[model samples]
Target: MAQNRDDDANDGSNGTSNRTSGIINSGRRGLMQGAGLGAALSLLGGVSGAGGLISTAQAAEAAFPQHKKWKIVFVNHVTTNPFFVPTQYGIQDACAMFGMDYQWTGSATSDAGEMVRAVNSAIAAKADAIAVPIVDPNAFDKPIQAALDAGIPVFAYNADAPRGKSNPRLAYIGQDLYLSGYQMGERIASLVDSGMVALFIATPGQLNIQPRLDGASDAIKKSGKKIDIQTVATGATVNEELSKIKSFYLGHQDLKGMFAVDAGSTQGVAQVMKESGLPSKGVHGGGFDLLPQTIQLIHEGFLDFTIDQQPYVQGFYTVMEAFVFLASGGLVGPANINTGLKFVTKDTVEPYLNTSTRYEGKTTKPQIVPMKGAIKS
Candidate 1:
């Protein structure tokens, strides 16, 4: 039977659909149904829109056809990563909205080898599409190419290809890492000219973060900010990372600022700065993502600012983009989605802090104001 997803989308928005007979079954939390090679591809061409079927409120209401069902596997770096929670929400909601099948599985710990294995497993399982964060450029080349050779559509999200145009993945969906880093660096250089400042990375070799360190260095040099930059490799565990940073700060009491690239490390970096009692001094700090704790730290004046990459949007759009590629027999790569690198200071953090959704890991109700009484955002 040909299925329509519109009703489910409407129901999701208005909270009303009761029918369980359609292709748009929001009730089916998670299920994988094998699709014929070509049958699965048909659903990717959503109705009446160049953007995927879930592009608008109306389009999202339509369902994936029973005959057009496709399964996708999202192999994330951190399955339990609070940062990707919004992204997971995006993937789950988008699939539910489109009536597609998807499974998100990955290494709980961030390991390139585990991610590659997960992608290979999905390929062996014959998933229609595979989305992954190719954080390590060299490590992912073979696995990504293999997925493409096997007819599974591969996409890079959250992280990007450092060596651009080198990988065969279909598309990338995330912030322009280098540019965002450049912007952050420009700001840091504007604040202070000469001092020993450090840029920290959670995974040293990971391409996404390394570029930020590069951008900061370039920007600092360009600004003529004789800033002594230290590129520190902090392991992912938050407390342990925080302890290492604190030890560094204690030894280098004359340090100026510390900029962080990864999400988990931001909070740790903020903590170390706060305890150092250098708020009045030239100790300024900034980080990449807006983890809840990071936002709270900013609000409390323990940190300067953090970035907002809009992870949910990243997850949602990447899947939808891959779906578009599959269903339309078209291709979607080099897709530009904003991470909304919002610089949240004490003044700006509070507005975003009231979010009910556990942005790093949970679902949320859209905050909507009725047209009759609404003031525009």
Candidate 2:
């Protein structure tokens, strides 16, 4: 008796056709069954003994097929900022790995209203998923809900809505902005002694940098030191930020230190300190991000330290969450992620200076570089 296809399906095995079936009456099939070792080897293209070709049905089931190519849209507050160069690379790498697509669009000047419009457009276009910075506390609330209502998943990255104010975005993937600033403030306290310290920011009330400014101010107040901290507003443009920093240095020659809460301002602080020879003047300075100039200045002792918030992973995990949600059909929920913050100073700036990779927003080519020494804490 010949076993049928239905019988093979119910057998709980590999679904190989049983030769005992009378339906396999062809002479070629009979010859393959008869010549045990040599014929089986030839049929299998190398294997010996009873091992031969699997049934067509079994082979089809064994193949691992590709998943649907889902598209994710990312809305940013600062669309052209260099700080997010690595973040874009992260999104690109993750999308390529998962066979997905992504779009980067947002306001160039951190306009909350513009970001809201982008969210609405994404919803209208029926995007698979969306990621946003949530830089405004109340601005994103309605738009995120609208996205959710449209059956599209949404996530937050780089920045998040304020605490105690509920925004409907799923998760955030960036540093604890306030905490990072508080810690930097403590460091500033140790370096400056009862003199004026200038804290520069590109945007004063913008959620992305405001919380950090608040944290730094709070930490300085908590220290109970006679430190006079002043917040200076640097314009959004890098050249404007640099000019402002230079002018500030010129006027506040007696200042004890300068620090910044944002990327462009941080680089400006480094440049001002270097040209003014502030370190030799016993004037300490530090700020956030690992801009190439910032790293070089830190190594040269022009600036004290700069924080690395792993911007690359912020984009990487945002896409990963979106992919999982689309693939698992909502069974896998997105979770908040904190991309780590690290202090890079003269002692630890070598690795950043030596490496030219996408992770650092340094280069476009992918590569693996050898480490020379044990990593420092």
Worst 10 residues of 1 by lDDT: 12-21
Cα lDDT for residue 114, model 2?
89
Q: Give a tens-digit lDDT track for model 2, residues 241-345.
A: 998999988998999999999989999999988887889989998999987888999988999999999988998888878866765678766788889779998
Among all candidates shown, the one with the greatest lDDT: 2
Q: How good is model 1 by TM-score?
A: 0.80
| Model 1: per-residue Cα lDDT over 125-232, one tens digit each | 898888888887687889888988888888888887885448888778888788778888998898777889878887776776777777777888889758888888
Q: State model 2's lDDT.
A: 0.77
Q: Model 1, residue 47: what's the lDDT?
A: 46
Q: Which sections of candidate 1 miss by over 4 Å? A: 1-23, 26-67, 331-340, 358-377
RMSD of each: 9.1, 16.6
